[model samples]
Target: MLIVEELHMLLLRPDGRVESAVSGNRLYGEVAAVLVDLALHGRISFSHEKHPTVDIVLTEPTGNPILDTTLQRLVPMRGKRLQSLVVSPKLDPLEVVVESLVVQGVLVRGERGFFGWGSERTPESDPAPELVLRSRLAAVLAGTGAPTQADLSLLSILQNLNAARAILRAECGDISARDLKKRIEQLTAGSPAGDAVAKAVNDAIAAAMVAIMTPVIVAATIT
Candidate 1:
């Protein structure tokens, strides 16, 4: 599964509702995840600066629908700061991601409430993928093994969402939430990938945070 897909899976409960704690930031996280996946696949690259800008290295389709769609969108936005892409309402991919997952039989769509006053729900049709992903993250976070570049990317996004503690606390054995948070920070800071890869992932994450927080800060100040 693509990292963004895995992230969507992670952000969901078995009931298919997005985890309440991270719902507000889910769109930003998914956007960042897609960008990071693109960078890791060599379809894109990031500039190193105070606020990083993304450049498309290859326009070839990635075959994955989500990545391909996002790539097409980025074609015209080359060299734009990552924050711009993340914050743009046009870039949110939740519906596409959900549709893809539904088609893959990873999630099953249903409805709640009576009559027509209901909301849609997408409970899991296949739970194995998410279970395996959770185990992998737990192993890495528990210091049992090293993390791949993908793992680092996912960790960086989760940390930015302040979500690692909520998602992995149970699977990480007896580790305190405080310690788990610290482990995520340590791993994200010192990714196991080579320097260039580490820098790209870290910079993308930083830009994502700026994009996510800018509106909240503005709204708070205005009020």
Candidate 2:
């Protein structure tokens, strides 16, 4: 599950200045970060409240030899710099948005690019552009509630490691996935719903990935 909520992001630029504000909703910033983490580790787990604004715990990669050191650097800052960034091998940020929305069930892949889902299929079908959807999702996951079905659909895209990671880097600011994975492992260790929620979220992500990517992959290979 993505932790989408409004957060106070305070960026300390090179010149010893402090820039702070509440940004990054569920679809864009926060969900983007989770997607990046999932690509590197294969799955993620977090906690949710009865209402919105739940705290989540992420699991890190255990076997990867190179991840230990990276974990050390990232674990301490899990909710800080690590929370609002994405990391991916690909450079197209829109890809992440596209994949996420498709997986989450918001925008469906049509003959052309992504199109919004509805019976009418009018020009207003996709009321929010991809960028707006991303931003809104990030805000919701951060504890804000501006998210719609579209935002949830986009988040579902992270179920695929390849697409999820690619989208992460393209859209959100770059961060280290290996490090984020380690941090999640340490943070989510003791939660009550840790194990069950992790499995559920992972399962959902997997199902969504197969549902969407199988066709695309087969077509690409054939072409």
Candidate 3:
């Protein structure tokens, strides 16, 4: 519970203001608990276990020393080495931060074209619309039923119009899952990313099905 709360405080808010995390001028145990939960959930994974450090880079460069310092202290307490990266319209803070984390053994950089700590070339700026769409889709697909990030990311590889529609229908299911699967196979043909997208859609559907199957626990369980 503490880890859960700490993560809530550390994450950025839409309004750009640090909320309940600042309360009492001390990071509560609850906050730390929340972050741990996040780590377990796979939203974040151990990049490098050797250094035991975490890095928080500032790309905007406005310089919020208080926030930065608070995060630095808060993260190390949770067990990690910390570093900061600064990026701008011209500066690649993300790259710098990722590199530092990789060096410190806090993160495992990804392959040639992937999202994570390390990459040979910088990625293009993704628009908010794309981010929001991906997020919504991801929410509709997660948990045990959730595919590994690799399977879920296949949507990016598709560029053709028909193929995209087929994949969307299969995952979304306007009528039947079987029908959608059939259509997807028909559209996929020989495309490399097709299998990936198909896997993603299946995972997405499986994730949603699990959500529906799960029961909410409102009361404490006693041994």
Q: Which candidate is the best by lDDT?
A: 1
Clashes of each: 0, 33, 23
lDDT of 2 by residue, 133-222 (tens): 456644644435544433433444332232333344433335355543343333334334334444334444444445555798999999
Task: Name the best candidate (by TM-score).
Answer: 1
Residue 211 displacement in candidate 2 (angstroms):
2.7
Q: What is the C-alpha lDDT profile of model 1 across 47-148, one tens digit per residue?
A: 777677889999999788888888888899999887677666666777778889999999998787577465578899999988898888888887897787
lDDT of each: 0.79, 0.35, 0.30
Ten residues in a row with the worst lDDT in model 2? 5-14
TM-score of each: 0.86, 0.26, 0.18
- Give the range of the ten consecutive residues with the poorest summed lDDT in model 1: 192-201
Q: After superposition on all CA atoms, how large is the RMSD of candidate 3?
A: 17.9
